[model samples]
Target: MNRERIIAIVAQARAGQATDEELQELADALDRDADGSVTSAMEESLQQGRQQIALPGREKADRMLADILETGQVLEDPGEEAETPAVIAPLKPGWKRYGRAVAAAAAILLLAGATYFLLRQSPRPEEAPVAGTNPLAPAAEGLPAGKKAVLTLANGATVMLDEQHNDTITRQGNTSIVKKEDGRLAYQPGNAAATGLALRNKVSTPRGGQYQVDLADGSRVWLNAASSLLFPVDFSGHERVVELDGEAYFEVAPDNSRPFMVKAGQTTVQVLGTHFSVSAYSDETLQKTTLLEGKIKVLAGNTGYQLQPGQQVVFDKIRAGSKLVPQANTEEAVAWKNGYFQFSGADATVLLREISRWYNIEVVFNGIPAGYELSGKIDRSIRLSSIVTALREGGVHCTLEDNRLIVNK
Candidate 1:
């Protein structure tokens, strides 16, 4: 049960050479060691393996672990002793497969003991049954969001955008609204001035849906779940303006004569051409504008502030104030567009709101501990059950009942 022995067992597990007895011994050691030595040994071995061998990045590793758990072979039943063999079969491939085995093995070892203990503990009366619903009932898993949106024409006609629908969806004035081969909505203009230059069109995504729009001006907009964008069918005015609700990422087309502007809530972002994201969910207190490329000016109330690349501005909806972040984590800000949820010390409610929108579920919080924060990155493509498991592993007691995620302190 020494540190070196634990490390050796972990290495064997990673190499797909560990025997059942050795795996059980390691599990016992992890159970007995309350001083964190066993966990440290496992971590050290994982770090050393990563440094010595070629392995996938964190995201890929997470996916591999998820795959293993979904198979229901990596971990034993919670009622049984936590002495499951880390790797039951020899790895077929080389280091690539070995890397995946190790990732799953380490996660199983680390989470097994902790989760078992937490589950074995008795629950208080207040945390017992949530609204008379069975806490132990199997909740239906939520599917990930996909390319689903509705395009509303100038005259209030609607077109559903999805895989089954393609080609020219409709015609608006001189603009032909087409659903491109790549599942994106595009506004292609024909020869002649657009007749209804004053009329506007809108694209909206319901909960658990997302869509992309290629504007007539060549600007591209990626709308997040439960978001909408309203813009003219053709850019004919002095300023190309768009109204946004919820969240969206924009790559504005350059036009010196006409600056592109996005109005979200009480904030307005004006740019000639830039890559940026605007998050202005009505349920959230803060609205943020993050700039990834080029320069832009953010106008909030009567005050205006200029932002450069890698900068962000947060507007407080309650206080009607704004603060500029000189060095922003632009990657975290646009993680949704890139296909994941990246959290760095994010609050519990903040994370729940995102889960609610993406999973299209209701979040009923019995009580969230004050000052609770979470930091991690999860693939957005995973099922809602996986997300709930992750939340439980992070010490956030919660359960999914029907379509509602009930969180308790």
Candidate 2:
């Protein structure tokens, strides 16, 4: 049960020379000696020793054995194989006699491949971060304005509005607008002249918060968290057209002459007067247009399909045939707008990203764990620690450091 006996037994096990009975005895002694703090340590040590023996060369195995014996961290006894060649120990006056040899062995292991592997496999120490700061916590500071607006035209030219970061940019006719330096374009509508150039106007919400906008022709738009909208600065002569790159809900102004159109990626959703949600983030493989009211037509590539109220159409480039699939829970699709991460079994990466955005933290994984689907609702206003605690309860261990979330298995 003492360290010396443990080390001798472990050495024999590593050499692939220990008998079954001897291995069992070693395990018993280790179990008695190691408390709960080292539950997996003995097992890990055994595995590493076995790996060293199994490696192609005898020299490599000896180096591994030396490394283990010297560390004093390895289990004294690892159950089983013990065919280790006898090692000559110099005359030792006392415990100090082993110290110099152990140091030399450590240096030798560094020269061998085992040390390289161990260094690579070792878990990095967590960096000191802002204490008690939860990545998922809601910002104590109120809404922070997002990025600059870049208006794109059908001709492919782009115009940057509010380039100066001035709080007050332009006052035209009855429109009073403010452009904060943070790239947030805040507008107040007023009477507008017909001579003003009509182009698609877009506003994107960054990581912090969401915004709502009313289009020129009375259409109402709710831009969800981390989403953006593109509409006309003023309605043109024909149909009202705009583009979307993220999640947004629209209550279109019904004008048969000026049908509201949403352009998302390769697909276009045309609605006369309907409520629908479009999620077209570039990271997502599928573009979804979910109708909540009235009717809408989704056109992708060469085909066009009509969607009924309460129906969702999904288009994917990777899958063959029609990609549209109905979602059982439509509320989850629009949860971001409502201020929560409404996941009904979402993948880890996507789920983590949402958590990161809400908490304003980075994420790093120790391993590529299996994709686990979890269904839950989290308030965006809550602290990051609260969310991480919930995940830990769900069987995932994570720690926070340097504004980053690190997962450990």
Candidate 3:
């Protein structure tokens, strides 16, 4: 389809003058234009025609979108009945185009209150609204994860670290643990003499929490949700080592005489000075170590693999084997650290697992297709309901009930 035609259709949709045929034509154009040209043209047209249309305010528009997403239907006029198409087919394969089309359609419908249209498939029959149960409405909102963690000192005492608490948290031997103003925990090394022993402290982030720590050795570590890092108060002895429980991104400080090592499960990542991320959640089947800069050697069992920038090493815990990916998707590997969920060809289970961890929710899958996969990016700062809405747009039929997420086929 040509750009001018797409713009005209978009303008008509935004002005509440598009016919059903034109809406279907727009959907077909979105599906055919894999390179996103049609979607971009539609967006541009929407932006250009915004001043011409008398739309609701931003807050009202947001409410409209939320209502539509939650109900999976257009807002009906005062007492008019909503019409249901005879056949509701399944969504097509390409989620990127589908998502864009949904967004565009949502903007048009919410802004102009145009005739209801379905850009893609609607929810299946089994997913219909039940009595006294709104599928998308959670008992309580699942807020986004924040800078919340616990610091365990060597004496078994714990200190809560969060936005409310700041300044010097405690002192461990010659290291002063301080919570910086920006919500990061930092270890300030003093010039005092040697202490009795180098005490080991642990910083752990529970589900729905994340934290960053500046080690005494000048290294920085960002812990993902449900992750922990165990390290000495000071990087004493021959090498600096930290034990990781879940996932973390590391920015190691250069120390030629001493290497920095991160031990997660049976896999060990050794580096002198580098930037990398290690994901070794116990529940996950594969342990991945992705190198973003410099170099590192991953030791899995008896084998060792050298990783360069943009490379990743994956170790299968069940199969007891390791593989190296030459061209790794580094953005997806460190998306958590960068405050987004970037899924590239990710399966439903994988995406839901991450969501469950970040939102601290339990997921119940009911007959979800085995090979279902999606690729998209969502801001991690949004509420769980918004994330669930995005998942639905991406063709994952799911609902948030209290703290549990139920996925239906």
Write down the TM-score for model 2: 0.56
lDDT of 3 by residue, 1-409 (tens): 7999988986775556888688667766755766768767865665576456444333344444444434433232222323211111124556444555544444444444422222233333344444676666746467879889999999999888874367898888899999998999999889986474879999999999999999999999999999999999997788998999999999999999999999999799999999999999998998999999999999986789999899999999999998999999897899888776665556668768898899889999897646665444445766677566555554566777888888877
TM-score of each: 0.74, 0.56, 0.77
lDDT values for all models: 0.72, 0.55, 0.74
Between prediction 1 and prediction 2, the one with superior TM-score is 1
Candidate 3 wrongly placed segments (more than 4 Å)? 9-27, 34-91, 94-126, 393-395
Best by TM-score: 3
Poorest stretch of ten by lDDT in candidate 1: 114-123
Q: Indicate which candidate wins on lDDT.
A: 3
189-308 per-residue lDDT for model 1 (tens digits) = 899976755879999999999999999999999999999999998988889999999999999999999999999999999999999999999999999999999999999766799999
